[model samples]
Target: MSTSIRSIKSLVPLLDRVLVQRIKAEAKTASGIFLPESTVKDLNEAKVLAVGPGGLDREGKRVPMGVQAGDRVLIPTFGGSPVKVGEDEYQLFRDSDILAKINE
Candidate 1:
Protein backbone atom coordinates (compact mmCIF):
# COMPACT_ATOMS: atom_id res chain seq x y z
CA MET A 1 0.00 0.00 0.00
CA SER A 2 1.17 3.55 -0.61
CA THR A 3 2.05 6.01 2.14
CA SER A 4 -0.85 8.17 1.04
CA ILE A 5 -3.17 5.22 1.50
CA ARG A 6 -1.86 4.48 4.98
CA SER A 7 -2.61 8.00 6.04
CA ILE A 8 -6.25 7.77 4.92
CA LYS A 9 -7.37 4.21 5.63
CA SER A 10 -10.08 5.57 7.83
CA LEU A 11 -11.93 6.51 4.68
CA VAL A 12 -14.12 3.61 3.58
CA PRO A 13 -15.96 4.13 0.32
CA LEU A 14 -19.55 2.95 0.16
CA LEU A 15 -21.43 0.77 -2.34
CA ASP A 16 -19.10 0.38 -5.31
CA ARG A 17 -17.43 3.71 -4.72
CA VAL A 18 -13.65 4.02 -4.77
CA LEU A 19 -11.15 6.42 -3.30
CA VAL A 20 -8.19 7.41 -5.42
CA GLN A 21 -5.17 9.65 -5.24
CA ARG A 22 -3.83 11.11 -8.45
CA ILE A 23 -0.26 10.55 -9.52
CA LYS A 24 1.66 13.79 -9.45
CA ALA A 25 2.61 15.52 -12.67
CA GLU A 26 6.27 15.75 -13.63
CA ALA A 27 7.99 18.90 -12.50
CA LYS A 28 11.05 18.51 -14.70
CA THR A 29 11.69 17.92 -18.36
CA ALA A 30 13.62 14.96 -19.83
CA SER A 31 16.52 17.36 -20.37
CA GLY A 32 16.53 18.18 -16.63
CA ILE A 33 15.00 21.59 -17.08
CA PHE A 34 12.49 22.42 -14.36
CA LEU A 35 9.03 23.09 -15.69
CA PRO A 36 6.76 25.77 -14.34
CA GLU A 37 3.57 24.88 -12.51
CA SER A 38 1.51 26.31 -15.34
CA THR A 39 3.05 23.79 -17.73
CA VAL A 40 2.20 20.77 -15.62
CA LYS A 41 -0.69 18.69 -16.89
CA ASP A 42 -3.05 16.88 -14.55
CA LEU A 43 -2.66 13.19 -15.24
CA ASN A 44 -5.55 10.77 -15.58
CA GLU A 45 -3.64 8.10 -13.70
CA ALA A 46 -4.16 7.42 -10.03
CA LYS A 47 -3.59 4.92 -7.25
CA VAL A 48 -6.51 3.23 -5.59
CA LEU A 49 -6.57 4.02 -1.93
CA ALA A 50 -9.74 2.35 -0.76
CA VAL A 51 -12.56 0.34 -2.24
CA GLY A 52 -16.10 -0.14 -1.06
CA PRO A 53 -17.66 -3.52 -0.59
CA GLY A 54 -19.39 -4.87 -3.65
CA GLY A 55 -22.93 -3.78 -4.27
CA LEU A 56 -25.95 -6.05 -4.21
CA ASP A 57 -27.60 -7.28 -7.36
CA ARG A 58 -31.25 -7.82 -8.13
CA GLU A 59 -31.09 -11.28 -6.63
CA GLY A 60 -29.39 -9.85 -3.57
CA LYS A 61 -26.10 -11.48 -4.50
CA ARG A 62 -23.03 -9.37 -4.04
CA VAL A 63 -21.48 -8.23 -7.29
CA PRO A 64 -17.78 -7.86 -6.73
CA MET A 65 -15.87 -4.81 -7.87
CA GLY A 66 -13.25 -5.12 -10.61
CA VAL A 67 -10.54 -3.07 -8.87
CA GLN A 68 -9.16 -3.03 -5.35
CA ALA A 69 -6.96 -1.04 -3.11
CA GLY A 70 -3.29 -0.78 -4.14
CA ASP A 71 -4.19 -1.04 -7.79
CA ARG A 72 -3.11 1.69 -10.20
CA VAL A 73 -6.01 2.80 -12.37
CA LEU A 74 -6.76 5.09 -15.27
CA ILE A 75 -9.48 7.67 -14.70
CA PRO A 76 -11.45 9.94 -16.96
CA THR A 77 -10.19 13.37 -17.94
CA PHE A 78 -13.17 15.04 -16.36
CA GLY A 79 -15.55 13.73 -13.70
CA GLY A 80 -15.21 12.19 -10.23
CA SER A 81 -15.85 14.24 -7.12
CA PRO A 82 -12.75 15.75 -5.54
CA VAL A 83 -12.15 15.01 -1.88
CA LYS A 84 -9.89 16.73 0.59
CA VAL A 85 -8.51 15.03 3.62
CA GLY A 86 -6.10 17.20 5.55
CA GLU A 87 -3.61 18.51 2.97
CA ASP A 88 -4.10 15.55 0.67
CA GLU A 89 -6.40 15.56 -2.34
CA TYR A 90 -8.40 12.49 -3.22
CA GLN A 91 -11.29 11.65 -5.54
CA LEU A 92 -14.38 9.52 -5.25
CA PHE A 93 -15.40 7.53 -8.29
CA ARG A 94 -17.80 4.77 -9.01
CA ASP A 95 -16.17 1.47 -9.91
CA SER A 96 -17.61 1.66 -13.40
CA ASP A 97 -16.30 5.17 -13.84
CA ILE A 98 -12.69 3.99 -13.62
CA LEU A 99 -11.38 3.51 -17.14
CA ALA A 100 -8.80 0.76 -16.65
CA LYS A 101 -6.23 -0.72 -14.30
CA ILE A 102 -2.59 0.07 -14.95
CA ASN A 103 -0.22 -2.87 -14.65
CA GLU A 104 3.13 -1.82 -13.24
Candidate 2:
Protein backbone atom coordinates (compact mmCIF):
# COMPACT_ATOMS: atom_id res chain seq x y z
CA MET A 1 0.00 0.00 0.00
CA SER A 2 1.03 3.57 -0.44
CA THR A 3 2.70 4.70 2.78
CA SER A 4 2.16 8.33 2.00
CA ILE A 5 0.75 10.42 4.81
CA ARG A 6 -1.81 11.82 2.41
CA SER A 7 -3.49 8.47 2.01
CA ILE A 8 -3.46 7.78 5.72
CA LYS A 9 -4.66 11.28 6.54
CA SER A 10 -7.89 10.51 4.77
CA LEU A 11 -8.94 8.55 7.80
CA VAL A 12 -10.03 10.53 10.84
CA PRO A 13 -10.48 8.59 14.04
CA LEU A 14 -13.44 9.38 16.25
CA LEU A 15 -13.97 9.77 19.98
CA ASP A 16 -10.59 8.90 21.47
CA ARG A 17 -9.80 6.30 18.87
CA VAL A 18 -6.38 6.20 17.29
CA LEU A 19 -5.07 4.92 13.98
CA VAL A 20 -1.65 3.35 14.11
CA GLN A 21 0.70 1.68 11.67
CA ARG A 22 2.88 -1.01 13.11
CA ILE A 23 6.61 -0.73 12.81
CA LYS A 24 7.73 -3.64 10.68
CA ALA A 25 9.84 -6.42 12.10
CA GLU A 26 13.45 -6.46 11.00
CA ALA A 27 14.46 -8.87 8.25
CA LYS A 28 18.04 -9.10 9.44
CA THR A 29 19.33 -10.55 12.69
CA ALA A 30 21.75 -8.87 15.11
CA SER A 31 24.71 -10.54 13.39
CA GLY A 32 23.45 -9.28 10.01
CA ILE A 33 22.12 -12.61 8.91
CA PHE A 34 18.97 -12.34 6.83
CA LEU A 35 16.10 -13.99 8.57
CA PRO A 36 13.31 -15.63 6.67
CA GLU A 37 9.97 -13.84 6.66
CA SER A 38 8.31 -16.61 8.63
CA THR A 39 10.87 -16.27 11.40
CA VAL A 40 10.54 -12.52 11.84
CA LYS A 41 8.65 -11.65 14.99
CA ASP A 42 5.99 -8.95 14.92
CA LEU A 43 6.99 -5.87 16.84
CA ASN A 44 4.67 -4.22 19.31
CA GLU A 45 5.85 -0.82 18.23
CA ALA A 46 3.67 1.53 16.23
CA LYS A 47 3.56 5.03 14.87
CA VAL A 48 0.51 7.09 15.54
CA LEU A 49 -0.98 8.37 12.33
CA ALA A 50 -4.20 9.95 13.47
CA VAL A 51 -6.17 10.51 16.63
CA GLY A 52 -9.74 11.34 17.39
CA PRO A 53 -11.02 14.26 19.36
CA GLY A 54 -10.87 13.48 23.03
CA GLY A 55 -13.89 11.87 24.54
CA LEU A 56 -16.37 13.72 26.70
CA ASP A 57 -16.34 13.44 30.44
CA ARG A 58 -19.30 13.35 32.79
CA GLU A 59 -18.81 17.03 33.44
CA GLY A 60 -19.22 17.68 29.70
CA LYS A 61 -15.60 18.61 29.33
CA ARG A 62 -13.46 17.24 26.58
CA VAL A 63 -10.72 15.00 27.93
CA PRO A 64 -7.58 15.57 25.92
CA MET A 65 -5.61 12.62 24.67
CA GLY A 66 -2.10 11.92 25.89
CA VAL A 67 -0.61 10.83 22.59
CA GLN A 68 -0.64 12.80 19.39
CA ALA A 69 0.03 12.14 15.74
CA GLY A 70 3.66 11.50 14.88
CA ASP A 71 4.36 10.00 18.26
CA ARG A 72 5.97 6.57 18.54
CA VAL A 73 3.99 4.40 20.91
CA LEU A 74 4.23 1.00 22.51
CA ILE A 75 1.20 -1.20 21.99
CA PRO A 76 0.03 -4.38 23.56
CA THR A 77 0.93 -7.65 21.93
CA PHE A 78 -2.63 -8.18 20.80
CA GLY A 79 -6.25 -6.95 20.80
CA GLY A 80 -6.52 -4.01 18.45
CA SER A 81 -8.78 -4.14 15.41
CA PRO A 82 -6.87 -4.47 12.14
CA VAL A 83 -7.34 -2.14 9.24
CA LYS A 84 -6.20 -2.60 5.65
CA VAL A 85 -5.50 0.35 3.46
CA GLY A 86 -4.33 -0.85 0.08
CA GLU A 87 -1.40 -3.13 0.93
CA ASP A 88 -0.66 -1.53 4.28
CA GLU A 89 -1.91 -2.78 7.62
CA TYR A 90 -3.01 -0.55 10.47
CA GLN A 91 -4.58 -0.94 13.88
CA LEU A 92 -7.32 0.91 15.71
CA PHE A 93 -7.14 1.27 19.44
CA ARG A 94 -8.67 3.48 22.07
CA ASP A 95 -6.49 5.97 23.88
CA SER A 96 -6.64 3.85 27.01
CA ASP A 97 -5.64 0.75 25.12
CA ILE A 98 -2.28 2.20 24.09
CA LEU A 99 0.39 0.98 26.48
CA ALA A 100 2.90 3.79 26.47
CA LYS A 101 4.52 6.57 24.48
CA ILE A 102 8.04 5.96 23.25
CA ASN A 103 10.63 8.66 23.31
CA GLU A 104 13.05 8.89 20.42
Candidate 3:
Protein backbone atom coordinates (compact mmCIF):
# COMPACT_ATOMS: atom_id res chain seq x y z
CA MET A 1 0.00 0.00 0.00
CA SER A 2 1.08 3.56 -0.68
CA THR A 3 0.96 6.31 1.88
CA SER A 4 -0.33 9.78 1.19
CA ILE A 5 2.01 12.72 1.27
CA ARG A 6 1.54 15.32 3.96
CA SER A 7 2.41 18.96 3.41
CA ILE A 8 5.04 20.65 5.56
CA LYS A 9 3.65 24.13 5.03
CA SER A 10 3.26 24.68 8.76
CA LEU A 11 6.99 24.17 9.32
CA VAL A 12 8.05 27.67 8.31
CA PRO A 13 11.26 28.70 10.00
CA LEU A 14 12.07 32.14 11.37
CA LEU A 15 14.43 34.68 9.87
CA ASP A 16 17.94 33.43 9.20
CA ARG A 17 16.86 29.97 10.29
CA VAL A 18 16.13 26.60 8.74
CA LEU A 19 14.62 23.23 9.54
CA VAL A 20 16.35 19.92 8.98
CA GLN A 21 15.46 16.29 9.29
CA ARG A 22 18.25 13.98 10.33
CA ILE A 23 19.11 11.03 8.17
CA LYS A 24 19.33 7.80 10.08
CA ALA A 25 22.51 5.83 9.80
CA GLU A 26 22.40 2.53 8.04
CA ALA A 27 22.13 -0.69 10.03
CA LYS A 28 25.30 -2.24 8.69
CA THR A 29 28.83 -0.94 8.88
CA ALA A 30 31.37 -0.66 6.08
CA SER A 31 32.35 -4.27 6.76
CA GLY A 32 28.73 -5.31 6.36
CA ILE A 33 28.15 -6.15 10.00
CA PHE A 34 24.70 -5.27 11.20
CA LEU A 35 24.42 -3.01 14.19
CA PRO A 36 21.74 -1.54 16.38
CA GLU A 37 21.03 2.07 17.17
CA SER A 38 23.00 1.93 20.41
CA THR A 39 26.03 0.49 18.66
CA VAL A 40 25.67 2.69 15.59
CA LYS A 41 27.50 5.99 15.34
CA ASP A 42 25.76 9.10 16.58
CA LEU A 43 25.57 10.84 13.20
CA ASN A 44 24.22 14.33 13.69
CA GLU A 45 24.15 15.07 9.98
CA ALA A 46 20.95 16.17 8.28
CA LYS A 47 19.45 17.51 5.06
CA VAL A 48 18.02 20.99 4.78
CA LEU A 49 14.34 20.99 3.96
CA ALA A 50 13.08 24.47 4.64
CA VAL A 51 14.85 27.81 4.92
CA GLY A 52 13.88 31.30 6.02
CA PRO A 53 14.33 34.52 4.15
CA GLY A 54 17.47 36.54 4.65
CA GLY A 55 17.97 38.16 8.02
CA LEU A 56 18.35 41.88 8.51
CA ASP A 57 21.86 43.13 9.08
CA ARG A 58 22.87 46.02 11.36
CA GLU A 59 22.28 48.39 8.46
CA GLY A 60 18.88 46.79 7.83
CA LYS A 61 20.11 45.10 4.66
CA ARG A 62 19.11 41.52 3.96
CA VAL A 63 21.88 39.04 4.58
CA PRO A 64 21.31 36.02 2.41
CA MET A 65 21.57 32.53 3.79
CA GLY A 66 24.57 30.61 2.58
CA VAL A 67 22.69 27.35 2.36
CA GLN A 68 19.43 26.51 0.70
CA ALA A 69 16.82 23.78 0.87
CA GLY A 70 17.92 20.28 -0.17
CA ASP A 71 21.51 20.84 0.86
CA ARG A 72 23.09 18.21 3.09
CA VAL A 73 24.61 19.65 6.22
CA LEU A 74 26.35 18.73 9.43
CA ILE A 75 25.14 20.08 12.74
CA PRO A 76 26.74 20.34 16.14
CA THR A 77 25.89 17.64 18.63
CA PHE A 78 24.79 20.23 21.17
CA GLY A 79 22.93 22.55 18.85
CA GLY A 80 19.36 23.18 17.76
CA SER A 81 15.97 22.49 19.35
CA PRO A 82 14.33 19.19 18.52
CA VAL A 83 10.77 19.04 17.28
CA LYS A 84 8.50 16.20 16.33
CA VAL A 85 6.59 16.33 13.05
CA GLY A 86 3.86 13.74 12.84
CA GLU A 87 5.77 10.49 13.28
CA ASP A 88 9.03 12.07 12.13
CA GLU A 89 11.44 14.28 14.07
CA TYR A 90 13.26 17.43 12.98
CA GLN A 91 15.43 20.21 14.33
CA LEU A 92 15.06 23.96 14.13
CA PHE A 93 17.95 26.32 14.66
CA ARG A 94 19.53 29.57 13.58
CA ASP A 95 21.70 29.68 10.49
CA SER A 96 24.74 29.80 12.71
CA ASP A 97 23.99 26.37 14.09
CA ILE A 98 24.94 24.72 10.82
CA LEU A 99 28.50 23.53 11.21
CA ALA A 100 29.28 22.75 7.59
CA LYS A 101 27.90 21.62 4.27
CA ILE A 102 28.94 18.40 2.62
CA ASN A 103 30.28 18.52 -0.92
CA GLU A 104 30.39 15.81 -3.57
Candidate 4:
Protein backbone atom coordinates (compact mmCIF):
# COMPACT_ATOMS: atom_id res chain seq x y z
CA MET A 1 0.00 0.00 0.00
CA SER A 2 1.03 3.58 -0.56
CA THR A 3 2.20 5.69 2.33
CA SER A 4 -0.68 8.11 1.92
CA ILE A 5 -3.37 5.48 2.34
CA ARG A 6 -1.72 4.11 5.43
CA SER A 7 -1.34 7.61 6.78
CA ILE A 8 -4.98 8.45 6.21
CA LYS A 9 -6.28 5.30 7.90
CA SER A 10 -4.61 6.42 11.08
CA LEU A 11 -7.25 9.09 11.49
CA VAL A 12 -10.30 7.85 13.35
CA PRO A 13 -13.44 9.93 13.35
CA LEU A 14 -15.54 10.43 16.45
CA LEU A 15 -19.24 10.71 17.25
CA ASP A 16 -21.27 9.61 14.24
CA ARG A 17 -18.90 10.97 11.64
CA VAL A 18 -17.64 8.85 8.76
CA LEU A 19 -14.46 9.09 6.77
CA VAL A 20 -14.67 8.32 3.08
CA GLN A 21 -12.65 8.47 -0.09
CA ARG A 22 -14.44 9.95 -3.05
CA ILE A 23 -14.45 7.93 -6.23
CA LYS A 24 -12.99 10.01 -8.98
CA ALA A 25 -14.90 10.72 -12.16
CA GLU A 26 -13.81 8.87 -15.23
CA ALA A 27 -11.39 10.77 -17.37
CA LYS A 28 -11.98 8.47 -20.27
CA THR A 29 -15.23 7.48 -21.91
CA ALA A 30 -16.45 3.97 -22.65
CA SER A 31 -15.20 4.35 -26.21
CA GLY A 32 -11.66 4.76 -24.87
CA ILE A 33 -11.54 8.42 -25.77
CA PHE A 34 -9.71 10.62 -23.31
CA LEU A 35 -11.62 13.64 -22.12
CA PRO A 36 -10.37 16.89 -20.88
CA GLU A 37 -10.42 17.72 -17.23
CA SER A 38 -13.02 20.42 -17.79
CA THR A 39 -15.41 17.86 -19.23
CA VAL A 40 -15.16 15.56 -16.25
CA LYS A 41 -17.97 15.83 -13.74
CA ASP A 42 -17.46 14.81 -10.14
CA LEU A 43 -19.28 11.70 -8.98
CA ASN A 44 -21.11 11.55 -5.66
CA GLU A 45 -20.00 7.96 -5.09
CA ALA A 46 -17.55 7.22 -2.30
CA LYS A 47 -16.04 4.32 -0.39
CA VAL A 48 -16.29 4.26 3.36
CA LEU A 49 -12.94 4.06 5.07
CA ALA A 50 -13.68 4.53 8.71
CA VAL A 51 -16.73 5.26 10.79
CA GLY A 52 -17.26 6.62 14.24
CA PRO A 53 -19.19 4.94 16.99
CA GLY A 54 -22.92 5.34 16.93
CA GLY A 55 -24.35 8.62 18.13
CA LEU A 56 -26.54 9.03 21.17
CA ASP A 57 -30.27 9.39 20.82
CA ARG A 58 -32.52 11.88 22.61
CA GLU A 59 -33.49 9.12 25.02
CA GLY A 60 -29.83 8.51 25.83
CA LYS A 61 -29.76 5.27 23.89
CA ARG A 62 -27.11 4.44 21.33
CA VAL A 63 -28.32 4.83 17.77
CA PRO A 64 -26.96 2.34 15.29
CA MET A 65 -25.12 3.70 12.28
CA GLY A 66 -26.65 3.32 8.86
CA VAL A 67 -23.40 2.47 7.15
CA GLN A 68 -20.23 0.67 8.10
CA ALA A 69 -16.62 0.75 7.10
CA GLY A 70 -15.92 -0.61 3.59
CA ASP A 71 -19.40 0.09 2.36
CA ARG A 72 -19.95 1.92 -0.89
CA VAL A 73 -22.32 4.82 -0.55
CA LEU A 74 -23.74 7.73 -2.43
CA ILE A 75 -23.00 11.09 -0.90
CA PRO A 76 -24.59 14.46 -1.33
CA THR A 77 -23.28 16.93 -3.85
CA PHE A 78 -22.22 19.36 -1.18
CA GLY A 79 -21.55 19.99 2.53
CA GLY A 80 -19.03 17.37 3.65
CA SER A 81 -15.92 18.50 5.44
CA PRO A 82 -12.80 18.19 3.27
CA VAL A 83 -9.82 16.38 4.69
CA LYS A 84 -6.30 15.90 3.40
CA VAL A 85 -4.20 12.94 4.44
CA GLY A 86 -0.69 13.01 3.15
CA GLU A 87 -1.16 13.28 -0.64
CA ASP A 88 -4.70 11.94 -0.73
CA GLU A 89 -7.95 13.79 -0.10
CA TYR A 90 -10.88 12.36 1.80
CA GLN A 91 -14.25 13.62 2.96
CA LEU A 92 -15.88 13.42 6.37
CA PHE A 93 -19.68 13.29 6.50
CA ARG A 94 -22.24 12.62 9.11
CA ASP A 95 -23.57 9.06 8.93
CA SER A 96 -26.97 10.61 8.31
CA ASP A 97 -25.68 12.78 5.48
CA ILE A 98 -24.75 9.76 3.40
CA LEU A 99 -27.50 9.53 0.80
CA ALA A 100 -27.65 5.76 0.46
CA LYS A 101 -25.62 2.59 0.60
CA ILE A 102 -24.85 1.27 -2.87
CA ASN A 103 -25.73 -2.35 -3.38
CA GLU A 104 -22.84 -3.05 -5.66
Candidate 5:
Protein backbone atom coordinates (compact mmCIF):
# COMPACT_ATOMS: atom_id res chain seq x y z
CA MET A 1 0.00 0.00 0.00
CA SER A 2 1.50 3.31 -1.01
CA THR A 3 0.78 6.31 1.16
CA SER A 4 2.06 8.57 -1.55
CA ILE A 5 -1.03 9.73 -3.35
CA ARG A 6 -1.74 12.28 -6.02
CA SER A 7 -3.00 15.79 -5.27
CA ILE A 8 -6.44 16.25 -3.70
CA LYS A 9 -7.57 18.99 -6.09
CA SER A 10 -9.98 16.49 -7.65
CA LEU A 11 -12.38 16.54 -4.68
CA VAL A 12 -14.41 19.73 -4.60
CA PRO A 13 -16.78 19.47 -1.68
CA LEU A 14 -20.22 21.11 -1.81
CA LEU A 15 -21.55 24.12 0.10
CA ASP A 16 -18.47 26.25 -0.48
CA ARG A 17 -16.18 24.04 1.55
CA VAL A 18 -13.23 21.74 0.92
CA LEU A 19 -10.82 19.11 2.21
CA VAL A 20 -7.37 19.60 3.62
CA GLN A 21 -4.22 17.59 4.07
CA ARG A 22 -3.15 17.86 7.70
CA ILE A 23 0.45 18.71 8.21
CA LYS A 24 2.77 16.23 9.90
CA ALA A 25 3.73 16.76 13.52
CA GLU A 26 6.87 18.55 14.41
CA ALA A 27 9.87 16.27 14.87
CA LYS A 28 11.01 17.93 18.07
CA THR A 29 9.16 18.74 21.23
CA ALA A 30 9.30 21.96 23.30
CA SER A 31 11.97 20.33 25.44
CA GLY A 32 13.87 19.25 22.33
CA ILE A 33 12.86 15.63 22.45
CA PHE A 34 12.57 13.87 19.12
CA LEU A 35 9.35 11.97 18.58
CA PRO A 36 8.46 9.17 16.25
CA GLU A 37 5.43 8.89 13.99
CA SER A 38 3.78 6.13 16.02
CA THR A 39 3.64 8.34 19.11
CA VAL A 40 1.56 11.07 17.53
CA LYS A 41 -2.10 11.39 16.74
CA ASP A 42 -3.32 13.60 13.89
CA LEU A 43 -1.42 16.83 13.37
CA ASN A 44 -3.53 19.96 13.82
CA GLU A 45 -2.16 22.24 11.15
CA ALA A 46 -3.25 21.74 7.55
CA LYS A 47 -3.28 23.21 4.09
CA VAL A 48 -6.56 23.61 2.26
CA LEU A 49 -6.60 21.82 -1.09
CA ALA A 50 -10.14 21.57 -2.43
CA VAL A 51 -13.18 23.81 -2.02
CA GLY A 52 -16.85 23.74 -2.89
CA PRO A 53 -19.02 26.22 -4.65
CA GLY A 54 -20.35 28.93 -2.39
CA GLY A 55 -23.37 28.16 -0.30
CA LEU A 56 -26.67 29.72 -1.33
CA ASP A 57 -27.98 32.76 0.47
CA ARG A 58 -31.64 33.37 1.25
CA GLU A 59 -31.57 35.97 -1.50
CA GLY A 60 -30.60 33.27 -3.99
CA LYS A 61 -26.97 34.31 -4.17
CA ARG A 62 -23.79 32.35 -3.52
CA VAL A 63 -21.97 32.97 -0.25
CA PRO A 64 -18.32 32.20 -0.73
CA MET A 65 -16.28 30.05 1.62
CA GLY A 66 -13.95 31.95 3.95
CA VAL A 67 -10.88 29.92 3.13
CA GLN A 68 -9.27 28.91 -0.13
CA ALA A 69 -6.83 26.28 -1.35
CA GLY A 70 -3.23 26.59 -0.08
CA ASP A 71 -4.38 28.39 3.04
CA ARG A 72 -2.71 27.20 6.23
CA VAL A 73 -5.27 26.74 8.97
CA LEU A 74 -5.60 25.48 12.50
CA ILE A 75 -8.07 22.64 12.78
CA PRO A 76 -10.03 21.59 15.81
CA THR A 77 -8.75 18.42 17.36
CA PHE A 78 -12.19 16.84 17.67
CA GLY A 79 -13.63 17.92 14.34
CA GLY A 80 -13.67 16.37 10.88
CA SER A 81 -14.26 12.89 9.42
CA PRO A 82 -11.34 10.53 9.09
CA VAL A 83 -10.55 9.10 5.67
CA LYS A 84 -7.84 7.10 3.97
CA VAL A 85 -5.94 8.72 1.17
CA GLY A 86 -3.89 6.10 -0.54
CA GLU A 87 -2.24 4.18 2.35
CA ASP A 88 -2.16 7.09 4.81
CA GLU A 89 -4.94 8.49 6.94
CA TYR A 90 -6.37 11.91 6.19
CA GLN A 91 -9.41 13.93 7.28
CA LEU A 92 -12.55 15.12 5.52
CA PHE A 93 -14.37 18.01 7.09
CA ARG A 94 -16.26 21.15 6.24
CA ASP A 95 -14.70 24.61 6.50
CA SER A 96 -16.08 24.76 10.01
CA ASP A 97 -13.51 22.24 11.18
CA ILE A 98 -10.94 24.91 10.74
CA LEU A 99 -10.41 26.85 13.96
CA ALA A 100 -8.19 29.64 12.71
CA LYS A 101 -6.24 30.79 9.71
CA ILE A 102 -2.46 30.68 10.17
CA ASN A 103 -0.71 33.85 9.08
CA GLU A 104 2.50 32.08 8.27
Candidate 6:
Protein backbone atom coordinates (compact mmCIF):
# COMPACT_ATOMS: atom_id res chain seq x y z
CA MET A 1 0.00 0.00 0.00
CA SER A 2 1.28 3.44 -0.90
CA THR A 3 1.42 5.90 2.03
CA SER A 4 3.07 8.93 0.48
CA ILE A 5 1.10 11.99 1.64
CA ARG A 6 2.10 14.59 -0.89
CA SER A 7 -0.14 15.27 -3.84
CA ILE A 8 2.82 15.28 -6.24
CA LYS A 9 4.01 11.83 -5.21
CA SER A 10 6.94 13.14 -3.21
CA LEU A 11 7.04 13.92 0.50
CA VAL A 12 10.35 15.31 1.55
CA PRO A 13 9.97 16.30 5.18
CA LEU A 14 11.59 19.59 6.09
CA LEU A 15 14.72 20.17 8.20
CA ASP A 16 15.71 17.43 10.66
CA ARG A 17 12.26 15.90 10.40
CA VAL A 18 11.41 12.34 9.49
CA LEU A 19 8.31 10.70 8.04
CA VAL A 20 7.64 7.31 9.50
CA GLN A 21 5.08 4.58 8.80
CA ARG A 22 4.14 2.64 11.89
CA ILE A 23 4.11 -1.12 11.99
CA LYS A 24 0.72 -2.43 13.03
CA ALA A 25 0.42 -5.28 15.41
CA GLU A 26 -0.86 -8.61 14.19
CA ALA A 27 -4.52 -9.45 14.82
CA LYS A 28 -4.19 -13.19 14.82
CA THR A 29 -2.62 -15.70 17.13
CA ALA A 30 -0.45 -18.80 16.54
CA SER A 31 -3.45 -21.08 16.66
CA GLY A 32 -5.42 -19.04 14.14
CA ILE A 33 -7.52 -17.33 16.76
CA PHE A 34 -8.47 -13.75 16.17
CA LEU A 35 -7.52 -11.14 18.73
CA PRO A 36 -9.30 -8.01 19.75
CA GLU A 37 -7.77 -4.63 19.12
CA SER A 38 -7.56 -3.93 22.84
CA THR A 39 -5.44 -7.03 23.39
CA VAL A 40 -2.84 -6.14 20.80
CA LYS A 41 0.24 -4.36 21.95
CA ASP A 42 1.10 -1.09 20.26
CA LEU A 43 4.25 -1.53 18.29
CA ASN A 44 7.08 0.90 18.76
CA GLU A 45 8.85 -0.01 15.55
CA ALA A 46 8.44 2.06 12.43
CA LYS A 47 9.88 2.21 8.92
CA VAL A 48 11.45 5.42 7.75
CA LEU A 49 9.53 6.81 4.81
CA ALA A 50 10.87 10.22 3.90
CA VAL A 51 13.33 12.56 5.53
CA GLY A 52 14.33 16.17 5.37
CA PRO A 53 17.67 17.79 4.73
CA GLY A 54 20.00 17.75 7.68
CA GLY A 55 19.55 20.54 10.17
CA LEU A 56 22.08 23.37 10.50
CA ASP A 57 24.30 23.82 13.46
CA ARG A 58 25.27 26.95 15.39
CA GLU A 59 28.62 26.89 13.59
CA GLY A 60 26.87 27.08 10.19
CA LYS A 61 27.65 23.44 9.48
CA ARG A 62 25.10 20.76 8.59
CA VAL A 63 24.26 18.24 11.27
CA PRO A 64 23.65 14.78 9.86
CA MET A 65 20.63 12.70 10.81
CA GLY A 66 21.07 9.21 12.23
CA VAL A 67 18.19 7.57 10.38
CA GLN A 68 17.23 7.54 6.72
CA ALA A 69 14.54 6.19 4.45
CA GLY A 70 14.05 2.44 4.67
CA ASP A 71 15.68 2.28 8.10
CA ARG A 72 13.67 0.68 10.90
CA VAL A 73 13.60 2.77 14.02
CA LEU A 74 12.23 2.53 17.52
CA ILE A 75 9.86 5.29 18.55
CA PRO A 76 8.14 6.25 21.76
CA THR A 77 4.59 5.00 22.30
CA PHE A 78 2.90 8.29 23.08
CA GLY A 79 4.67 11.09 21.28
CA GLY A 80 5.19 12.38 17.70
CA SER A 81 2.79 14.40 15.61
CA PRO A 82 0.19 12.31 13.85
CA VAL A 83 -0.72 12.57 10.20
CA LYS A 84 -3.76 11.09 8.54
CA VAL A 85 -4.28 10.44 4.86
CA GLY A 86 -7.39 8.66 3.69
CA GLU A 87 -7.75 5.95 6.35
CA ASP A 88 -4.08 5.49 7.11
CA GLU A 89 -1.93 7.22 9.70
CA TYR A 90 1.72 8.19 9.85
CA GLN A 91 4.06 10.09 12.14
CA LEU A 92 6.43 13.01 11.91
CA PHE A 93 9.30 13.27 14.34
CA ARG A 94 12.40 15.33 14.75
CA ASP A 95 15.58 13.31 14.28
CA SER A 96 16.62 13.92 17.85
CA ASP A 97 13.40 12.43 19.17
CA ILE A 98 13.81 9.01 17.64
CA LEU A 99 14.72 6.47 20.29
CA ALA A 100 17.05 4.20 18.31
CA LYS A 101 17.61 2.61 14.94
CA ILE A 102 16.76 -1.07 14.81
CA ASN A 103 19.17 -3.30 12.88
CA GLU A 104 16.42 -5.62 11.71
C-alpha lDDT of all candidate models, in order:
0.88, 0.88, 0.81, 0.90, 0.74, 0.85
| Deviation of model 1 at 37, angstroms | 0.8
Q: Give the TM-score of candidate 5.
A: 0.74
Candidate 5 lDDT over 1-104, as tens digits, reads: 23344654445578856677789877779999988878866668888877777778899898878888888988888767665656656666676567899998
lDDT of 1 by residue, 1-104 (tens): 12344457788899889999999888999889999999999999999999999788899887899999999999998888887766888899999999999998
Q: List pairs with backbone clashes in candidate 2.
A: none
| Residue pair clashes in candidate 4 | none
Can you write out model 6's per-residue Cα lDDT over 1-104, one digit (the tens) per residue?
A: 34545552265788899989899888999998999989999799999998888899999777898899999999988778887776777889999989999996
Best by lDDT: 4
Which residue runs of candidate 1 sit more than 4 Å off their true CA positions?
Answer: 1-7
lDDT over C-alpha atoms for residue 103 of model 2: 95
Lowest lDDT sum, 10 consecutive residues, model 3, at 1-10
What are the per-residue Cα lDDT tens digits for candidate 3 across 1-104? 12232555577787898888887899898999998768767687899999899689999987898789999998888868777755677887788779899985
RMSD of 6: 3.5
lDDT at 88, model 4: 83
- Stretches of candidate 6 off by over 4 Å are 1-9
> Where is the poorest 10-residue window by lDDT in model 6?
1-10
Model 2 misplaced regions, further than 4 Å: 1-6
lDDT of 4 at 65: 88
- Residues 1-104, model 4: lDDT tens digits: 22344588688888899999999988999999999999999899999999999788999887888999999999999999988766788899999999999998
Candidate 6 backbone clash number:
0
Extract clashing residue pairs from model 5.
none
